[model samples]
Target: MSIKPSRGKPLDVGAIGLGPDALPAMADTAAQSRFDFRAWWPEDRRELPYELEIGSGKGTFLVQQAQQMPDTNYLGIEYAGQFARYAADRLRRHNLNNVRMLAYDAAVFVEWFCPDASFRQVHIYFPDPWPKARHHKRRLIQTPLLRQLHRVLTPNGFVRIVTDHDDYYAWIEDHVAQVTDLFERQPFERPIGAGEGEVVGTNFERKYRREGRPFNALSLRKL
Candidate 1:
Protein backbone atom coordinates (compact mmCIF):
# COMPACT_ATOMS: atom_id res chain seq x y z
CA MET A 1 0.00 0.00 0.00
CA SER A 2 3.05 2.26 -0.14
CA ILE A 3 2.73 4.93 -2.82
CA LYS A 4 5.82 5.66 -4.85
CA PRO A 5 6.26 9.37 -5.33
CA SER A 6 6.33 11.04 -8.71
CA ARG A 7 8.88 13.81 -9.28
CA GLY A 8 8.12 17.41 -10.34
CA LYS A 9 4.55 17.37 -9.08
CA PRO A 10 3.17 20.37 -7.17
CA LEU A 11 2.18 18.01 -4.35
CA ASP A 12 5.26 16.24 -3.10
CA VAL A 13 3.48 13.10 -1.98
CA GLY A 14 6.62 11.24 -2.91
CA ALA A 15 8.56 13.33 -0.40
CA ILE A 16 6.31 11.74 2.18
CA GLY A 17 7.00 8.28 0.64
CA LEU A 18 3.75 8.01 -1.29
CA GLY A 19 3.59 7.06 -4.98
CA PRO A 20 1.70 8.13 -8.11
CA ASP A 21 -0.33 4.95 -7.86
CA ALA A 22 -1.84 6.47 -4.77
CA LEU A 23 -3.85 8.76 -7.05
CA PRO A 24 -6.52 7.84 -9.52
CA ALA A 25 -5.11 6.67 -12.86
CA MET A 26 -6.79 9.59 -14.62
CA ALA A 27 -5.89 12.24 -12.12
CA ASP A 28 -4.91 15.55 -13.66
CA THR A 29 -1.24 16.31 -13.23
CA ALA A 30 0.00 19.64 -11.96
CA ALA A 31 1.99 20.41 -15.09
CA GLN A 32 -0.22 23.23 -16.45
CA SER A 33 -2.26 21.04 -18.74
CA ARG A 34 -5.90 21.64 -19.52
CA PHE A 35 -8.32 19.36 -17.65
CA ASP A 36 -11.00 17.46 -19.51
CA PHE A 37 -13.86 16.67 -17.20
CA ARG A 38 -15.89 15.18 -20.02
CA ALA A 39 -13.16 12.64 -20.65
CA TRP A 40 -12.76 11.89 -16.97
CA TRP A 41 -16.09 10.10 -16.96
CA PRO A 42 -16.77 9.51 -20.61
CA GLU A 43 -19.52 7.00 -20.13
CA ASP A 44 -21.73 9.57 -18.46
CA ARG A 45 -20.09 12.66 -19.92
CA ARG A 46 -22.26 15.77 -19.64
CA GLU A 47 -25.29 13.57 -19.08
CA LEU A 48 -25.26 13.15 -15.33
CA PRO A 49 -25.24 15.97 -12.83
CA TYR A 50 -21.84 16.57 -11.21
CA GLU A 51 -20.91 17.45 -7.66
CA LEU A 52 -17.54 18.27 -6.12
CA GLU A 53 -16.17 18.27 -2.62
CA ILE A 54 -13.10 20.15 -1.50
CA GLY A 55 -10.82 18.72 1.17
CA SER A 56 -12.64 15.45 0.94
CA GLY A 57 -10.76 13.74 3.72
CA LYS A 58 -10.79 9.91 3.57
CA GLY A 59 -13.67 9.89 1.03
CA THR A 60 -16.43 9.02 3.48
CA PHE A 61 -18.86 11.69 2.28
CA LEU A 62 -18.12 11.16 -1.38
CA VAL A 63 -18.56 7.40 -1.12
CA GLN A 64 -21.81 7.75 0.72
CA GLN A 65 -23.20 10.34 -1.71
CA ALA A 66 -22.11 8.34 -4.74
CA GLN A 67 -23.79 5.30 -3.31
CA GLN A 68 -26.97 7.11 -2.42
CA MET A 69 -27.28 9.03 -5.69
CA PRO A 70 -26.25 6.72 -8.45
CA ASP A 71 -27.46 9.15 -11.10
CA THR A 72 -24.98 11.84 -10.13
CA ASN A 73 -21.19 11.89 -10.44
CA TYR A 74 -18.95 12.75 -7.52
CA LEU A 75 -15.44 14.22 -7.55
CA GLY A 76 -13.31 14.89 -4.54
CA ILE A 77 -10.12 16.91 -4.18
CA GLU A 78 -7.83 16.13 -1.27
CA TYR A 79 -4.58 18.00 -0.72
CA ALA A 80 -3.16 15.38 1.59
CA GLY A 81 -1.65 12.48 -0.29
CA GLN A 82 -2.38 9.92 2.37
CA PHE A 83 -6.04 10.82 2.45
CA ALA A 84 -6.27 10.96 -1.32
CA ARG A 85 -4.72 7.51 -1.71
CA TYR A 86 -6.88 5.99 0.97
CA ALA A 87 -10.02 7.46 -0.61
CA ALA A 88 -9.11 6.30 -4.09
CA ASP A 89 -8.41 2.81 -2.84
CA ARG A 90 -11.65 2.75 -0.93
CA LEU A 91 -13.67 3.75 -3.99
CA ARG A 92 -11.88 1.17 -6.14
CA ARG A 93 -12.43 -1.54 -3.59
CA HIS A 94 -16.12 -0.77 -3.55
CA ASN A 95 -16.19 -0.77 -7.37
CA LEU A 96 -17.76 2.65 -7.36
CA ASN A 97 -17.33 3.98 -10.85
CA ASN A 98 -19.32 7.15 -10.28
CA VAL A 99 -16.58 8.75 -8.22
CA ARG A 100 -13.06 10.03 -8.88
CA MET A 101 -10.42 11.77 -6.77
CA LEU A 102 -7.55 14.22 -7.15
CA ALA A 103 -4.62 14.85 -4.84
CA TYR A 104 -4.14 18.58 -5.50
CA ASP A 105 -4.61 21.96 -3.99
CA ALA A 106 -8.30 22.73 -3.98
CA ALA A 107 -8.07 26.38 -4.94
CA VAL A 108 -5.64 25.82 -7.76
CA PHE A 109 -7.70 22.97 -9.14
CA VAL A 110 -10.90 24.93 -9.04
CA GLU A 111 -9.41 27.99 -10.69
CA TRP A 112 -7.55 26.18 -13.41
CA PHE A 113 -9.35 22.93 -14.14
CA CYS A 114 -13.01 23.47 -13.49
CA PRO A 115 -15.21 24.84 -16.23
CA ASP A 116 -17.57 27.75 -15.66
CA ALA A 117 -21.09 26.97 -14.51
CA SER A 118 -20.35 23.26 -14.42
CA PHE A 119 -21.26 21.90 -11.03
CA ARG A 120 -24.62 21.22 -9.43
CA GLN A 121 -23.19 21.45 -5.92
CA VAL A 122 -19.88 22.00 -4.16
CA HIS A 123 -19.12 20.87 -0.62
CA ILE A 124 -16.33 22.17 1.56
CA TYR A 125 -16.39 20.49 4.94
CA PHE A 126 -14.08 21.18 7.85
CA PRO A 127 -11.30 23.07 6.05
CA ASP A 128 -8.30 24.25 8.03
CA PRO A 129 -9.27 27.19 10.19
CA TRP A 130 -5.69 28.59 10.19
CA PRO A 131 -6.51 30.09 13.56
CA LYS A 132 -3.50 32.33 14.08
CA ALA A 133 -3.99 35.91 12.98
CA ARG A 134 -0.69 35.74 11.12
CA HIS A 135 -1.89 32.61 9.27
CA HIS A 136 -5.28 33.99 8.31
CA LYS A 137 -4.04 34.41 4.76
CA ARG A 138 -3.91 30.65 4.48
CA ARG A 139 -7.62 30.28 5.17
CA LEU A 140 -9.45 28.73 2.20
CA ILE A 141 -12.70 30.68 2.09
CA GLN A 142 -11.23 34.00 1.02
CA THR A 143 -12.80 36.51 -1.35
CA PRO A 144 -10.59 35.61 -4.31
CA LEU A 145 -11.45 31.94 -4.02
CA LEU A 146 -15.09 32.89 -3.59
CA ARG A 147 -15.02 34.67 -6.94
CA GLN A 148 -13.61 31.57 -8.59
CA LEU A 149 -16.32 29.51 -6.96
CA HIS A 150 -18.97 31.86 -8.22
CA ARG A 151 -17.69 31.51 -11.74
CA VAL A 152 -17.56 27.73 -11.66
CA LEU A 153 -20.99 27.17 -10.24
CA THR A 154 -24.04 26.97 -12.44
CA PRO A 155 -26.78 29.47 -11.75
CA ASN A 156 -28.61 28.39 -8.60
CA GLY A 157 -25.82 25.93 -7.75
CA PHE A 158 -24.95 25.82 -4.09
CA VAL A 159 -21.81 25.69 -1.97
CA ARG A 160 -22.18 24.02 1.39
CA ILE A 161 -19.56 24.63 4.07
CA VAL A 162 -19.20 23.25 7.57
CA THR A 163 -16.68 24.14 10.23
CA ASP A 164 -16.10 23.48 13.92
CA HIS A 165 -14.11 26.66 14.48
CA ASP A 166 -16.06 29.70 15.58
CA ASP A 167 -13.61 32.35 14.46
CA TYR A 168 -13.39 30.84 11.00
CA TYR A 169 -17.16 30.76 10.80
CA ALA A 170 -17.29 34.51 11.44
CA TRP A 171 -14.47 35.05 8.98
CA ILE A 172 -16.33 33.11 6.30
CA GLU A 173 -19.51 35.04 6.94
CA ASP A 174 -17.69 38.33 6.57
CA HIS A 175 -16.10 37.43 3.28
CA VAL A 176 -19.23 35.80 1.92
CA ALA A 177 -21.13 39.00 2.69
CA GLN A 178 -18.73 40.96 0.54
CA VAL A 179 -19.72 38.88 -2.45
CA THR A 180 -23.45 39.44 -2.16
CA ASP A 181 -23.82 40.11 -5.88
CA LEU A 182 -22.38 36.70 -6.78
CA PHE A 183 -23.77 34.68 -3.93
CA GLU A 184 -26.59 34.83 -1.44
CA ARG A 185 -26.89 33.03 1.88
CA GLN A 186 -29.26 30.10 2.00
CA PRO A 187 -30.66 28.31 5.03
CA PHE A 188 -29.72 24.70 5.71
CA GLU A 189 -31.21 22.12 8.03
CA ARG A 190 -29.40 18.95 8.97
CA PRO A 191 -31.19 15.86 7.72
CA ILE A 192 -33.37 14.46 10.46
CA GLY A 193 -33.92 10.78 11.11
CA ALA A 194 -37.08 9.32 12.58
CA GLY A 195 -35.66 9.02 16.08
CA GLU A 196 -32.19 10.58 16.28
CA GLY A 197 -32.74 13.80 14.31
CA GLU A 198 -29.85 15.49 12.47
CA VAL A 199 -28.63 12.19 11.07
CA VAL A 200 -26.57 13.45 8.15
CA GLY A 201 -23.06 14.29 9.24
CA THR A 202 -19.53 13.87 7.97
CA ASN A 203 -16.86 11.88 9.80
CA PHE A 204 -15.28 15.01 11.28
CA GLU A 205 -18.73 16.38 12.09
CA ARG A 206 -19.51 13.27 14.14
CA LYS A 207 -16.17 13.42 15.94
CA TYR A 208 -16.55 17.09 16.79
CA ARG A 209 -20.08 16.49 18.03
CA ARG A 210 -18.94 13.67 20.28
CA GLU A 211 -16.23 15.92 21.73
CA GLY A 212 -18.91 18.49 22.64
CA ARG A 213 -17.68 20.92 20.03
CA PRO A 214 -20.37 22.87 18.21
CA PHE A 215 -20.06 23.22 14.46
CA ASN A 216 -21.63 25.64 11.98
CA ALA A 217 -23.03 24.95 8.54
CA LEU A 218 -23.54 27.51 5.76
CA SER A 219 -24.98 27.32 2.31
CA LEU A 220 -24.72 29.87 -0.52
CA ARG A 221 -26.43 29.95 -3.86
CA LYS A 222 -24.84 31.21 -7.09
CA LEU A 223 -26.81 34.27 -8.23
Candidate 2:
Protein backbone atom coordinates (compact mmCIF):
# COMPACT_ATOMS: atom_id res chain seq x y z
CA MET A 1 0.00 0.00 0.00
CA SER A 2 1.26 3.44 -0.89
CA ILE A 3 1.72 5.67 2.13
CA LYS A 4 0.80 9.34 1.73
CA PRO A 5 1.20 10.99 5.10
CA SER A 6 -1.08 13.95 5.70
CA ARG A 7 1.65 16.05 7.34
CA GLY A 8 5.03 17.04 5.88
CA LYS A 9 6.34 16.71 2.34
CA PRO A 10 8.37 13.89 0.86
CA LEU A 11 12.14 13.66 1.19
CA ASP A 12 14.18 14.12 -1.95
CA VAL A 13 15.98 10.82 -1.95
CA GLY A 14 17.23 11.71 -5.41
CA ALA A 15 16.70 9.57 -8.46
CA ILE A 16 15.75 6.29 -6.94
CA GLY A 17 14.90 4.28 -10.05
CA LEU A 18 12.26 2.11 -8.48
CA GLY A 19 9.11 3.58 -6.99
CA PRO A 20 7.54 2.54 -3.69
CA ASP A 21 4.88 0.41 -5.34
CA ALA A 22 7.61 -1.70 -6.92
CA LEU A 23 9.41 -2.22 -3.63
CA PRO A 24 7.32 -3.20 -0.66
CA ALA A 25 10.44 -3.54 1.48
CA MET A 26 11.41 0.09 0.86
CA ALA A 27 9.90 2.87 2.94
CA ASP A 28 7.79 5.53 1.29
CA THR A 29 9.83 8.69 0.91
CA ALA A 30 6.80 10.82 1.84
CA ALA A 31 6.91 9.22 5.27
CA GLN A 32 10.29 10.84 5.84
CA SER A 33 9.02 14.40 5.99
CA ARG A 34 7.05 13.95 9.20
CA PHE A 35 7.33 10.40 10.38
CA ASP A 36 4.48 9.02 12.45
CA PHE A 37 5.59 5.59 13.45
CA ARG A 38 2.09 4.26 14.06
CA ALA A 39 0.99 5.33 10.58
CA TRP A 40 4.06 4.37 8.58
CA TRP A 41 4.84 0.95 9.99
CA PRO A 42 2.85 -2.15 9.18
CA GLU A 43 -0.43 -2.18 11.11
CA ASP A 44 0.24 -5.33 13.10
CA ARG A 45 3.84 -4.36 13.82
CA ARG A 46 3.13 -0.76 14.75
CA GLU A 47 3.08 -1.59 18.44
CA LEU A 48 6.44 -3.32 18.35
CA PRO A 49 9.46 -1.52 19.76
CA TYR A 50 11.63 0.06 17.10
CA GLU A 51 15.35 0.44 16.56
CA LEU A 52 16.92 2.86 14.10
CA GLU A 53 20.06 2.15 12.15
CA ILE A 54 21.85 4.95 10.32
CA GLY A 55 24.12 3.84 7.53
CA SER A 56 22.93 0.26 7.39
CA GLY A 57 25.23 -0.72 4.57
CA LYS A 58 24.12 -3.88 2.74
CA GLY A 59 21.63 -4.57 5.56
CA THR A 60 24.06 -6.93 7.30
CA PHE A 61 23.45 -5.83 10.89
CA LEU A 62 19.71 -5.34 10.46
CA VAL A 63 19.22 -8.64 8.65
CA GLN A 64 20.91 -10.37 11.54
CA GLN A 65 19.03 -8.44 14.19
CA ALA A 66 15.61 -8.80 12.55
CA GLN A 67 16.20 -12.52 12.35
CA GLN A 68 17.29 -12.80 15.95
CA MET A 69 14.69 -10.46 17.43
CA PRO A 70 11.40 -11.00 15.68
CA ASP A 71 9.52 -8.86 18.14
CA THR A 72 11.43 -5.69 17.28
CA ASN A 73 10.90 -3.47 14.26
CA TYR A 74 13.83 -1.79 12.49
CA LEU A 75 14.12 1.22 10.23
CA GLY A 76 17.37 1.91 8.41
CA ILE A 77 18.20 5.17 6.67
CA GLU A 78 21.07 5.19 4.21
CA TYR A 79 22.15 8.23 2.24
CA ALA A 80 23.56 6.18 -0.56
CA GLY A 81 20.69 5.30 -2.85
CA GLN A 82 22.17 2.11 -4.22
CA PHE A 83 23.01 0.76 -0.81
CA ALA A 84 19.52 1.56 0.39
CA ARG A 85 17.96 -0.35 -2.49
CA TYR A 86 20.30 -3.26 -2.02
CA ALA A 87 19.59 -3.46 1.69
CA ALA A 88 15.83 -3.27 1.15
CA ASP A 89 16.07 -6.01 -1.45
CA ARG A 90 18.02 -8.17 0.96
CA LEU A 91 15.29 -7.79 3.56
CA ARG A 92 12.67 -8.66 0.98
CA ARG A 93 14.59 -11.71 -0.22
CA HIS A 94 14.87 -12.97 3.32
CA ASN A 95 11.12 -12.38 3.86
CA LEU A 96 11.80 -10.13 6.81
CA ASN A 97 8.79 -7.85 7.13
CA ASN A 98 9.75 -6.17 10.35
CA VAL A 99 12.50 -4.06 8.84
CA ARG A 100 12.43 -1.28 6.24
CA MET A 101 15.08 0.83 4.53
CA LEU A 102 14.97 4.38 3.21
CA ALA A 103 17.36 6.16 0.86
CA TYR A 104 17.75 9.52 2.56
CA ASP A 105 20.10 11.54 4.73
CA ALA A 106 19.72 10.15 8.22
CA ALA A 107 20.70 13.41 9.91
CA VAL A 108 17.86 15.38 8.39
CA PHE A 109 15.41 12.57 8.91
CA VAL A 110 16.27 12.30 12.58
CA GLU A 111 16.21 16.03 13.24
CA TRP A 112 13.05 16.82 11.34
CA PHE A 113 10.81 13.78 11.25
CA CYS A 114 11.46 11.26 13.97
CA PRO A 115 9.06 11.40 16.93
CA ASP A 116 10.22 11.94 20.49
CA ALA A 117 11.01 8.87 22.58
CA SER A 118 10.18 6.59 19.67
CA PHE A 119 13.13 4.26 19.41
CA ARG A 120 14.67 1.69 21.72
CA GLN A 121 18.16 1.88 20.24
CA VAL A 122 20.03 3.63 17.45
CA HIS A 123 22.91 1.95 15.64
CA ILE A 124 25.68 3.70 13.73
CA TYR A 125 28.71 1.76 12.59
CA PHE A 126 31.72 2.60 10.44
CA PRO A 127 30.41 5.99 9.26
CA ASP A 128 32.79 7.87 7.02
CA PRO A 129 35.37 9.77 9.06
CA TRP A 130 35.54 12.53 6.43
CA PRO A 131 39.08 12.41 7.78
CA LYS A 132 40.30 15.68 6.31
CA ALA A 133 40.04 18.52 8.80
CA ARG A 134 38.10 20.64 6.33
CA HIS A 135 35.40 17.97 5.88
CA HIS A 136 34.94 17.10 9.53
CA LYS A 137 31.74 19.11 9.68
CA ARG A 138 30.24 16.63 7.23
CA ARG A 139 30.77 13.79 9.67
CA LEU A 140 27.60 12.30 11.22
CA ILE A 141 28.61 12.36 14.88
CA GLN A 142 28.26 15.97 15.95
CA THR A 143 26.53 18.09 18.60
CA PRO A 144 23.26 18.75 16.76
CA LEU A 145 22.85 15.15 15.69
CA LEU A 146 23.60 13.96 19.19
CA ARG A 147 20.95 16.26 20.58
CA GLN A 148 18.41 14.96 18.09
CA LEU A 149 19.42 11.43 18.92
CA HIS A 150 18.83 12.09 22.58
CA ARG A 151 15.42 13.53 21.85
CA VAL A 152 14.25 10.80 19.52
CA LEU A 153 15.34 7.92 21.71
CA THR A 154 13.19 6.63 24.55
CA PRO A 155 14.37 7.52 28.04
CA ASN A 156 17.28 5.22 28.76
CA GLY A 157 17.48 4.23 25.12
CA PHE A 158 21.04 3.49 23.95
CA VAL A 159 23.13 4.69 21.04
CA ARG A 160 25.79 2.21 20.00
CA ILE A 161 28.64 3.22 17.72
CA VAL A 162 31.68 1.54 16.23
CA THR A 163 34.47 3.07 14.20
CA ASP A 164 37.74 1.87 12.75
CA HIS A 165 39.46 5.25 12.63
CA ASP A 166 41.12 6.39 15.83
CA ASP A 167 40.92 10.08 14.92
CA TYR A 168 37.23 9.82 14.15
CA TYR A 169 36.63 7.95 17.38
CA ALA A 170 38.34 10.80 19.25
CA TRP A 171 36.18 13.22 17.30
CA ILE A 172 33.07 11.33 18.34
CA GLU A 173 34.08 11.39 22.01
CA ASP A 174 34.66 15.14 21.86
CA HIS A 175 31.21 15.84 20.38
CA VAL A 176 29.50 13.40 22.73
CA ALA A 177 31.29 14.91 25.69
CA GLN A 178 29.49 18.18 25.10
CA VAL A 179 26.19 16.38 25.75
CA THR A 180 27.19 14.51 28.91
CA ASP A 181 24.19 15.77 30.82
CA LEU A 182 21.85 14.32 28.26
CA PHE A 183 23.57 11.01 27.73
CA GLU A 184 25.70 8.94 30.09
CA ARG A 185 28.59 6.91 28.80
CA GLN A 186 28.30 3.16 29.11
CA PRO A 187 30.44 0.17 28.19
CA PHE A 188 30.12 -0.91 24.55
CA GLU A 189 28.89 -4.46 24.38
CA ARG A 190 29.32 -6.59 21.30
CA PRO A 191 26.03 -7.40 19.66
CA ILE A 192 24.34 -10.66 20.57
CA GLY A 193 25.60 -13.67 18.57
CA ALA A 194 28.56 -11.73 17.17
CA GLY A 195 31.61 -13.78 16.41
CA GLU A 196 34.69 -13.54 18.61
CA GLY A 197 36.71 -10.37 17.93
CA GLU A 198 33.77 -8.81 16.08
CA VAL A 199 32.08 -5.64 17.25
CA VAL A 200 28.71 -4.82 15.72
CA GLY A 201 29.40 -7.52 13.14
CA THR A 202 28.53 -5.38 10.12
CA ASN A 203 30.08 -5.95 6.73
CA PHE A 204 32.44 -3.02 7.23
CA GLU A 205 33.52 -4.35 10.62
CA ARG A 206 34.29 -7.74 9.13
CA LYS A 207 36.19 -6.19 6.21
CA TYR A 208 38.14 -3.84 8.44
CA ARG A 209 38.92 -6.66 10.85
CA ARG A 210 40.38 -8.68 8.02
CA GLU A 211 42.54 -5.66 7.18
CA GLY A 212 43.84 -5.65 10.76
CA ARG A 213 42.41 -2.23 11.53
CA PRO A 214 41.90 -1.31 15.17
CA PHE A 215 38.39 -0.47 16.39
CA ASN A 216 36.93 1.76 19.06
CA ALA A 217 33.34 1.83 20.23
CA LEU A 218 31.11 3.44 22.86
CA SER A 219 27.55 3.29 24.14
CA LEU A 220 25.47 6.15 25.49
CA ARG A 221 22.18 5.87 27.32
CA LYS A 222 19.78 8.78 27.17
CA LEU A 223 19.44 10.48 30.53
Best prediction by TM-score:
2
Predictions: Cα RMSD each: 7.0, 8.6
TM-score of each: 0.81, 0.84
Error in Å for residue 184 of model 1: 1.0
Q: Cα deviation in Å at residue 37, candidate 1?
A: 1.4
Q: Score each candidate by Cα lDDT.
A: 0.74, 0.79
**Residues 97-211 of candidate 2: C-alpha lDDT, one tens digit per residue:** 7787877788877876677898999999999999999999899999999999998999899999999999999999999989998999999988773666678789898988889
What value does the lDDT take at residue 115 in candidate 1? Answer: 70
Model 2 TM-score is 0.84
Candidate with maximal lDDT = 2
Model 2: ten consecutive residues of lowest lDDT: 11-20
